[model samples]
Target: MKNLLSLLTIAFLSTGVFAQTTWKADKAHSQVSFGITHMTISEVEGLFNEFDATIEASEEDFSDAKYTVEIEVPSIDTGVEMRDNHLRNADFFDAEKYPKMTFVSTSSEKVGEGKYKVTGDLTFHGVTRPVTLDVWHRGTVKDQKGNLISGFAISGEVKRSDFNLGPDFPEAVLSDKVVIDVDAEFKKA
Candidate 1:
């Protein structure tokens, strides 16, 4: 009886140490987008039509969460086909040379209720740079299909010159700062 009790205790403790939840981005409900100043007169927005994101967490509040995202460089769309094509060319992203942009979180710290500061390495245009982004947990819910879903909003900024993107264009032509916004829904996996 003592041996059986010891074995049960170990099993319970092991589960706590090894258990983690994985969440996959629901593509139908998620968006990866960005905005940048155009000619220093107005802002132009664009989005990547194809991307993948995943999160792994052990804590319920996601204080120990890790995130990863990959975006197809050629999938950029800016409502104007000409501009989109330009963005994918050598003058901008050079999609033929760098086909994928990715990000991986290095640390996450909870700042307030449902809010966190996530620092990660963002790789774009063949350049990798560390960036810090603000993240908001919109909450979690169960869908009619009995699947658990969680929503998150992420916002940050990156400099065009940092990655040598559109190097030929001056700040007046294409603002150096590019703003990023992501709204994503993850289904428990």
Candidate 2:
């Protein structure tokens, strides 16, 4: 009887230990981009070439998942070399002062199939604010190399005013709204 009890205890302990899975971002197959109004009529898009993310979740649905992502500020690219350099200086992102920006999930809710409303604190320009991202799980599959892969598409918006970037730029030229989009893939680790 004691041996049976010991077996049961070990089973439960191992179940808890193995329930959580970790996924590492596949940066080569992922992208993070942003868009904002350039002249109130045209949109200017930018991409961050370097970023990292990790996802941790229980074996069940990802309703309780935890997400963390960091983007290197110096990697900002807007397709124009001159403009990119100008934006990287202290007048804009001040990449030297704030080398990285990050987003960490505080809560997540599964609203529908493969969709989630994730609320998190976005820290940028040395400031932090709450943002809710619309996240969609693009499904999971196995690669030819026999590796598990998962994809996600995330979208959200933030007010530049909330992050100390609004007052620095003239409203007529650069709006206070910034849209973030991330289409990323992760490999099971």
- For residues 75-172, write the lDDT of model 2, one tens digit per residue: 99999999899888878888999999999999998999989999999998889999999999988899999998989999999998888864668868
lDDT of 1 by residue, 1-189 (tens): 999999999999988976799999999999999999988899999999999999999887888999999999999999999999999999999999999999999999999999999999999898999999999999999999999999999999999999999999999889999999999999999
On lDDT, the candidate that comes out on top is: 1
Worst 10 residues of 2 by lDDT: 57-66
Cα error, candidate 2, residue 186 (Å): 0.5
Clashes of 1: 0
Model 2, which residues run further than 4 Å from truth?
Answer: 2-18
Candidate whose TM-score is highest: 1
**In candidate 2, residue 4 scores what lDDT?**
100
Those runs of model 1 whose alpha carbons end farther than 4 Å from true positions after fitting are: 3-7, 13-18
Q: How accurate locally, in lDDT, is each candidate? A: 0.96, 0.91
Report residue 61 deviation for candidate 2 (angstroms).
3.0
